[model samples]
Target: MLLADGIHAVITDRHGGISAEPYTSRNLGGAVGDDFDAVLRNRHDTAVELGVDPARVVMMRQVHGRDVRFVTEPFGDDPPPLDAIYTTEPGLALNVLVADCAPVLLADPVARVVGAAHSGRPGTQLGVVPALVEAMATRGAEPYQMVALIGPAACGLCYEVPAEMREDVARVVPEAWATTRQGTPAVDIRAAIEAQLHKANITDIRHDARCTIETPDLFSYRRDSRTGRFGGFIWLDGG
Candidate 1:
C-alpha cells in the first residue's frame, strides 16, 4: 500500500518477518511483547523496503491523544510519547503502529513536508487530525494542498461500542456515529477522520477501505487482543 508523489508513504501489513505466534509475521511493534529482535528486524526490513534508512526511522509510542512532534532528526533511543509526527527533513521515516486504530498519512509534496498520525477513538474525539494539520502548517504546509491517506482499521459495523461511549465520541465526531450489524451503537473512525480532513479543507484524501477486524490480512486488536501491530510510514526523498 503506497500513496502520494515525491513523498513515500507505505502501509505495512502482517505478512513478512520473524515475530512468533500472536504477534505473527511482520510485527513492527517492539513493546507489544513480540520478540524484540524480531520487531527490530521487521522495522529494519520495512525501512529498507521503503528505501528509507533504518537508523533514521522514528516510531512513536502512541498514547491515543492529540500530541504532535516536529522531527528534524531521529530520537536516539526512546520513542516519543505522541500520536502524530511531522517532518520536513528527508531520510527520516515517520511510523505509526496500529492494530485497529486508524493510521493516517499526510503530505504536502510542494512543501516537501509529511506527517503520520494515529487516530484512535479517544484521539479522534480530541481532534488529532486537526492538530496534525496545524503542526504541518508550521512547516509551510497548508490543508488545501495536502494529500491525506487513511489506512485499514476497524469499520463501524465491526466496532460496536457502548451507547454512552458512542454518544461522547459523536459529540466531537458526529460523522462517526453509526449502527452496527446487530443494531448496536458503533463509531466509524475512518468516516470521522475523512470528515475531519474535509473540515480541514484537505480535498485530496484516499482511504484503504479494508477493515482490520474483518480483513484477515491485517492485524486486529479487536479480533485478537494479543495480535501484533502493522505499521504506516511516510518519508521525504532526500535524494
Candidate 2:
C-alpha cells in the first residue's frame, strides 16, 4: 500500500528467505538466533525488491517504547535504540522489525517523507505512533496530508491478551473494547493505532486483514516461541 506521494514500500512475509528451521525461510532479524548471514541475505533481497540500497535502509535495536528518531541520513554503523523512525530524504529507507507486533508505514506525499514504526503491546502502551507523528512534523509533515498504512499484524481474534494487559489497553482508550471479537479478549492494535492517528488528525488509513499469528506464511513471536522476524520498510523514490 502507498503511504505518501512518490513513495513506495511493502511489508514482507517469512516465506521467501534463506533461513532454516524456526527461522524457516525469510527471517530478517540478526539477533534472534538465526544465522547472521541468513538474516543479511534476507535483508539484502528485501532491499533489492524495494529498489533501495541495502546500506540505506536504516533500522534500530527496538527497545519497545515510544522512542522515535528522525534520520537526516543513513546510519554510519550500528543503529540507535528506537521504536519508530522517520526520514524526509530520498533513498534512505526506514525499516522496523516485527513478528506479531504491528508495523505502521506513514507518509506525507506532499512532503516527500515517510516513517515506519514497531508497535507491539509495549510500544502501543507507550504511544509510539503519536511520537512518530510529532517527529515527522518537526521535519515538516502535516497530519492532514499524511496517509497511514497499518500492515499485517496479530489480529485481535488470534491475540488473546491477559486480563491485566487488557486493562492496560483499556486505560489508553476505553473504546478499544469495541475491537474485542471473540471469547478470549483480544486487542485490535490497528484500531488502537488508528484511534491515535485520528487524534493526530491523520485521516488516511488502510488496514491489511492478514493476521501474522494465524497465517503460516508470515512469522509470529507469540505463535512460535523461537520465530524470526519479518520487516516493513519504506523510502521516498529516487531517480
Q: Evaluated with TM-score, which candidate comes out highest?
A: 1
What is the C-alpha lDDT profile of model 2 across 35-81, one tens digit per residue?
Answer: 99888899898888777888788888888899888887766557778
TM for every model, in the order presented, reads: 0.97, 0.94
- Find the number of clashing residue pairs for candidate 1: 0
Off by over 4 Å in 1: none
lDDT of 1 by residue, 1-239 (tens): 34566788888899988889988799988778888988889889878887888889888888989999998887777877899999998778898999999999999998889999999899999999899999899989988889999999999998999999999999988999989999999999999999999999999999888999998889999999888999888888873
lDDT of 2 at 21: 99
Which residue pairs does candidate 1 place in steric collision?
Answer: none
**What's each prediction's clash count?**
0, 2
> 151, model 1: CA deviation in Å?
0.5
Candidate that scores best on lDDT? 1
